[model samples]
Target: MTTRTASARYDGMGRTGKGHITTQSGILTDQYYGFNTRFEDEPGTNPEELIAAAHAACFTMALSFALERAGFRDGTLETKAAVKLEQSDGGFTITRSDLVLDASVPGISPDQFAEIAAGAKANCPVSKLLNAEITLEHHLK
Candidate 1:
């Protein structure tokens, strides 16, 4: 098994607080994020954006491997994930993550492609990690 880590530090409180997030990969080094970034149209990154990126990258890589396993060596899989955060009595909850995929794989039937894509969507690590509802829409070209 492999492990990864990320850290966040917050100073002050609530909407006025400031935060910096850092990841083990160093791709995000003390990146800034807080209420303004998450709830408003402010610059910097939010947890939801990071989650979407992780889901998109993970699902695409999983589909690539699945395609190779199914004898498809050349293809492009592009995915976009949209994560929805909803406010409720319990604060905010991530309600769903919708994946949109654009694929170009020669010599594959739509049915076959859909099957493999569905399998990858169901089995990808990030997909499995998310507790929210997951939906996938694919365009095969």
Candidate 2:
């Protein structure tokens, strides 16, 4: 089994707390995240954006492999995932993730592309991991 890990450290409490995140690959070493970064428009990363990035990357890679398995060799795929966080009765909850895909695959019909993209969106690890609603919109280029 393949497992990736990341760590987050938070000092202080509540809005005054400061947090740093680190990834196993060191791509995000000592990355800052906190109330200002999340609730306010501070210059730092936050959890929602990180989840979005993961979702986008996972879905795009899944689509690429699915396409190759279907005998398509060359193509380009770009995906953007938008994650929404809302205030729930208890606290805060992640409501949904919306994915937008721009794709260029030669000799692919709309119906075939839709089928493959839907499969990838449904089966991607990140998508399966989330409890929130997921939606996908794709454009053929």
Candidate 3:
């Protein structure tokens, strides 16, 4: 197990601020993300979208490995994670993360696929790390 790192910097305060985010892998090198991107839907990325990407990637990889261990090697799993950010009395909070998966696995029963997918959804590292509510909806084709 290893540690991963990312950093962000903001140049101003509140809605007028500009920020940049960078990751260890350099996938996001000085990528812009700030008030406009987050609240106003301007160009660039945001924290919620980053969380969604992380969740989707982690869950899909976990399911791929689980399927391999279950003796089903050949399949395609496409997972999309939507993270919800809500504003309430307590300020802003990430309320939920919903995962929708489209899977194509040969020679597997619907029951078995559902079971495995559920297990992956429950046990994936990102899911475990999240403090918000997590829901998984999977479609097998």
Tell me the whole-model lDDT of each prediction, alpha carbons only.
Answer: 0.96, 0.98, 0.95
* Per-residue accuracy of model 2 over 1-141 as CA lDDT, tens digit each: 999999999999999999999999999999999999999999999999999999999999999999999999998999999999999997999999999999999999999999999999999999999999999999997
Native-to-model Cα distance after best TM-score fit, residue 66 in candidate 2, in Å: 0.5
How do the residues 71-111 of candidate 3 rate in per-residue lDDT, one tens digit apiece? 99898999999999999996999989999999999999999
Question: Worst ten-residue run, lDDT, model 3?
Answer: 33-42
Flag clash pairs in model 2.
none
How many clashes (backbone atoms < 3 Å, residues ≥3 apart in a chain or on different chains) does model 3 have? Answer: 0
Error of 1 at 99 (Å): 0.3
Error of 3 at 33 (Å): 0.6
Best by lDDT: 2
Clashing pairs in 3: none
How close to the true structure is residue 114 of candidate 3, measured as C-alpha lDDT? Answer: 94
**After aligning candidate 3 to the native by TM-score, how far in Å is the CA of 10 from where it should be?**
0.3
Point to the candidate with the largest TM-score: 2
lDDT of 1 by residue, 1-141 (tens): 999999999999999999999999999999999999999999999999999999999999999999999999998888999999999997899989999999999999999999999999999999999999999999999
